[model samples]
Target: MNRAFNRKRDKTWMHTPEALAKHYIPYNAKFLGNTEVEAPKGTEVVEDAVRKLKFQRHIKKSEGQKVPKVELQISIYGVKILDPKTKDVHHNCQLHRISFCADDKTDKRIFTFICKDSESNKHLCYVFDSEKCAEEITLTIGQAFDLAYKKFLESGGKDVETRKQIGTLQRRIQELETENSELKKQLQDFEEQLMMVHGSPAGSISIQTQSTDVFDMVPFSPVTPLVPTQANNASPPPPPTTLPPDISKDLFGAEPFDPFTCASADFPPDIQSKLDEMQEGFKMGLTLEGTIFSLDPLDERC
Candidate 1:
């Protein structure tokens, strides 16, 4: 029974949640004194003897003051003073608000620092006595401050890099937008030119596709000749007469020939006989076959 109970207890303990680890340093120090001091506004004022005078005056004021035992807690965020017995907070000064911290050269057990009061808006000097651990306390505070500053720089660097990337992306987006606008303008101009050439909008233009086959392109229709009608009774035109060979040179020349008036003695026998037959045919109002017709007017024809 005892062995079973022990096993169960061990299992229960193992299953229980563990606490998260906390990081901080605590030192026992005697609060020597605190005094309000003039805030340094610039490097010149900081380097002047006025700060030294204030420091000396604060030290003098702390000479007879009662020293109270307090706990100085240091962390990456800030420093705090707590009552050792009741665990009550006395003062809390954030790391960023602390302006200065230094150890006394004459006494290794004494250290002093100045911080801005959040509520009073004043600079206050605090002096502490930590016996042999004075240097260790100051060193711990310095280390915490260093770590915090390094962390701040790391975060700030990431933010700066992110901003640079965002800026580059923004600039690239702007360039692409500008290029897009130019392309749109060019497209509009090209469309306008197309409209001017085609006498219509580009979208409204149509393509006339020609048939590939010759037979499909032309319509096949039977042609019909017109029949004669009584209302339009007109005789068909006579066939055109044939012109004699060399007629332009012989009949219409500067010196024309008069066949009938010409003497038979001036022509060959064959030509004289042909001319006699043509003149007789013209006077009888008859057309002779295979005979050249005279160009004279006829009164009637059979």
Candidate 2:
């Protein structure tokens, strides 16, 4: 494993046990062939040929190969194979990437597990010779897997709760926006009604409208008089016995004159004769004044 990868992994929370065991990878089983070993019946024959070739390659690689020994350190973080004497790390796999772990069916002292390679992202088999502690190592790996899964579920639950809260807030915002729009519409209607009642727009007045400055000032007077005070309370004075002058008699005659009703036949003959004489005198006065003014102008010319 890369030193930088190990440093990054060290930053995470992990539980490390004191137990350590000798570990190695069988040359032949270090990595399984990438191709699928199983196929449908019709394709099985062709797949089988490919599988045999892969097995032969494994056998040839394993011949006379000497496996290097390392120390197996298992933890909640994953599996680490360290150089026993130098303490240098050779391989590291994360807990979540491990797919399988158990004791070999033929050898009880051999602990084996399949984990994905961090660098290549390929599943590789690790074999540990734990002697009498193989079962304990396998149990530790199982417990680590359980812990990792539980953490995953907890994080997922928190995400779901956060999403629900966000949705509720968004709905509340939409409701407020709808209410705000309705309030704006109501205000506009109120302004229009006010305009109709006051005979003006909401914020403006017509220039032709009369001002109420005098009415708004103090010392207002009532049209009717106030009640008399106790000291001044007395019976009103009686009207005078003398009658007012007859305006119609002075303008026309003793009877009230009606231009629409009175005709030439309605007048007595004697009063009609007097009216004709007054009309002739009025015409004679106008003619004498005109002659005097005309004689003066002629005298100036002479």
Clashes of each: 0, 0
In model 1, state the lDDT of residue 266: 42
- The runs of at least 3 residues in candidate 2 whose Cα sits more than 4 Å from the true structure, single-residue gaps closed, are 1-65, 151-302
TM-score of each: 0.39, 0.34
Candidate 1 on 215-298: residue-level lDDT in tens? 443233365212211112334333223333342232224333333243222444565444443333222221111111122323
Clashing pairs for model 1 are none
- The C-alpha local distance difference test score for the whole of candidate 1 amounts to 0.51
- Which pairs clash in model 2? none
Best by TM-score: 1
Model 1 regions more than 4 Å off: 1-22, 40-65, 155-302
